[model samples]
Target: MDVELKSLTGNGTWSVVSLPKDKKPVGCKWVYKIKRNPDGTVERFKARLVAKGFTQQEGVDFIDTFSPVAKLVTVKLLLALAATQKWSLTQMDVTNAFLHGDLEEEIYMSLPPGYTDTSSGSLPPRPVSSNDTAAEEALKILLRSHFKIKDLGPLKFFLGLEIARSSQGISVSQRKYCLELISDTGLIGSKPVTVPLDPNVSSHKETGPTLVDLTPYRALVGPHMKAAQRVVRYLKSNPGQGLFYSVNSDMQLKAFGDADWAQCPETRRSVSGFCVFLGSSLISWKAKKQHTVSRSSTEAEYRALANTTCCAPDKGGEKDCGADFSKGHDRFKSSERCLLLDGDDVAYTEWF
Candidate 1:
């Protein structure tokens, strides 16, 4: 706790202050965690002094608060692209992520420096990683000169996702996370399934039951709980099974998607999912039920097709995703990529 306070003081997080006319000081507490390596071993002990931000009133302590969080999908997509490029992912400790956002809110620095001063904010710890050797080493030099920092080595357990590297490619899985979820829900002895969801389960459309004791685990409640349990059972069956991205320059992107029209009798909305591949390895995949209902099966298939075009570009930003198609998609400026629909309902006048 003493060390945490000293670090906060060193970072210029706050100053010794007296309570204002009707205001109170926010309380803080030290949080400890056992940081571990990728091989399920203890790496180090971490201590962080976090403020009780939840106790603050809306307009009393601050107006608004915003924290940036990285999505799991983006992480996998980047790893897939890295495998294709034959680049390894390494971790980097950044001093401040909200260097620009701190100017608007006074939640960071004790002293309000001039407009030119950019290093006043007390941004949260960023465990970001990169593949570029030059840029990463350059950043380390910059952080060392300004703040007291330490290197945590190669990327391991990040945001609850385990990363494994090899000569062939990188493998990512949520095995530990899945196990913890199963143990929390007391489903260790449950039977395994080949897939996550049951196709014949019609109760998914209606509210089955409410789990009064286990509401925090949303996946373990109501009709969703059964499907969630099935997913956990499947994870238990193949805990080591993960996305294996191989090193190759194929760069050819292939997309496959399907839609079940009016799949949910509860909502009448269609379900669509797509997986984009960079050569033989699958890079990204997502399943989502449409917000709006589709009248016809073709419309649902077309909606799924629309999602395929946007998935690679939105998720895989740094890569030359657009170049994969080359002249194959030249004529498809308005709505690019060829669409292949399943079943016999392949009737479209404008396209195909």
Candidate 2:
């Protein structure tokens, strides 16, 4: 507690100012969590002072909330390149990164324990952890010169994901996080399934009991929380399994896309998912519901293909063909360094 407070004070997060006549400063609370290692070991205990952002009125207390964050695809892309080039991937942590950044707009806080506005959901080494070893090192020095950062040494646990390095390649997983999720939802010792979603339980969703609680379904959560639990169970079964970027993996970029036509019972929107690979290294993948309903399967497939192509931006080089494609709502394409996809949206494979 003292350490956390000292760090906050040293960083100039907020000062104990005199209470104004009319200002009602927002209240703050301390949040705590236990960090664990990939092998189910306790890593460290963390405590954070957070303000009740819910109480603050938008456009009054704060104008706009824009958090600069990196997509998961970026992480996968870096991992893929590291695997192909056999580069050493290290992870660093900025204890209070958001507190250091210069905000565009100004906002004042009330008395008592003043609050520091948070930036994003989680930290995943955005603008860091790239393939270029020397460039990355240079960046580290520059960052150290500016902000107070701790070199954790070798990327191990990051944003709930566990990373392990070996002679063959680097492996990444979220086993610890999955188990915690299962425990949180009270699904311990439950039978695991092969897929993330259980088809039988989710089938015939025309009449399902509505969950009244709204907090549970914030993110990766829903009305029943069953889907989240099911995903946790699936992850439990393959706790140690994760992306394996091999040392011998080639740099050939390829992508695949597909979609489930009108699969959602509640929403008529079709589902699109896709995955991209560099040689044999799986770099990125996405699965999401379509915005609009497609009239025909071909139309849905084409939309998915267009999405894939857009995502598979050219990495400033020529790509060549690497994978075979099949008919009926499936597409493939490749970029110089990345591959693009749509509903059931993914891979459009034509190597430049």
Top lDDT hit: 2
lDDT of 1: 0.61
Worst 10 residues of 2 by lDDT: 319-328
Per-residue lDDT tens digits of candidate 1, residues 197-258?
Answer: 77666565355576685664565553466666677788878776777878763665566666
lDDT of each: 0.61, 0.64
Residue by residue across 1-352, what tens digits does model 2's lDDT show?
4556667677776656666677776766777777666777787777776777888888787777877866566566667666655666677777677786676643344432433432111254433455577888898999799877677777777666677888888888877776667777666888888898766776444445666865655655543466776777787777768888888876566768776778777867787777776667776777777899987666666666567656663543222221222221223633222232232433334532
Off by over 4 Å in 1: 38-45, 55-63, 95-136, 205-210, 216-223, 314-316, 319-352
For each candidate, C-alpha RMSD in Å? Answer: 6.8, 7.0
Q: CA shift at 209, candidate 1, in angstroms? A: 5.2
TM-scores for all candidates?
0.75, 0.75
Residue 103's lDDT within candidate 1 is 38
